[model samples]
Target: MSSLKPILLVEDNPRDLELTLAALEKCQLANDVIVARDGEEALSLLTHRDPGSGEFTLVPAVVLLDLKLPKVDGLEVLERMKGDPETRHVPIVMLTASREESDLVRSYQHGVNAFVVKPVNFRDFFQAIRDLGVFWAILNEPPVTTRRPPASTYAKGV
Candidate 1:
């Protein structure tokens, strides 16, 4: 596992954040987890640029996003990310407590890779998080990006 790739967690609720962190820790996932308190912060982190080099920072392996958030909601965030070519490839999982069918439909429409309802029971929540961490961080294969040849190269046909 590449330690450079972090897991982006966008959750506003402190208790939920703590519980999620604990669950991930208990599962012993080696990847680092970066927390974003709200949707705005999550977007900032994902699109952050270095002042000196003007280069983007770490790209997360996966994003665990909550539905209800401050500044911007999860669905909006998902929409923005999916719309942008730079961030569109990053897998986003809707990890929320909402059971609304509309939210689920909208999430999938906005290109959310997965949607997981937060379990109320402690044991169930822990197990769910653990499974999610294992699958996304260790098992899932991200899409491969192929660079398009330059127009000149194609023009030459050599």
Candidate 2:
């Protein structure tokens, strides 16, 4: 289930981010949770290169992305990621406060692995995030990918 892989959390709201972090911590998952306050930062982290090895560093097993975001929206991020073979296999879960059916439909159409509506109740939201952490990070089996292929790989029709 790629337990060693990290979990990427892309959230713009500070309160939600804190709650999610706390919930994940309660889960006691061995996987590290990388936080990005916005979609742009999330994408940057995903494609960040290591200074030592010159390789991408944020190849996570699962990405918990928020629907509405600053700079690039969640749907745009989802589309870009899904369009790329390198990141296409990474499971993306839409964790948002939006209850719009259109948003859910759009998310699924864009290939989001799961969509979770954030609960208004603090306890409910905490438990939901904890459950997600346990399932996605511990129980769910993910594809094995050391690192995604470079952009050039796509250019040659790979």
TM-score of 2: 0.87
Q: Residue-wise lDDT of candidate 1 within 17-96, one digit each (tens)?
A: 99999998898887778888899988988787656655556477789999999999999999999999988998999999
User: Residue 93: error of model 1 in Å?
Assistant: 0.5
Cα lDDT computed for each candidate against the true fold:
0.83, 0.84
Worst 10 residues of 2 by lDDT: 149-158
Query: After best superposition, candidate 1 residue 42: deviation in angstroms?
Result: 0.4
Instruction: Give the Å shift of residue 8 in candidate 2.
Output: 0.7
Each prediction's total of clashing residue pairs, residues at least 3 apart in sequence or on different chains, is: 0, 0
Compose the digit string of candidate 2's lDDT tens values, residues 29-61. 877777888889888877767677677766776
Instruction: For candidate 2, give the lDDT of residue 23.
Output: 93
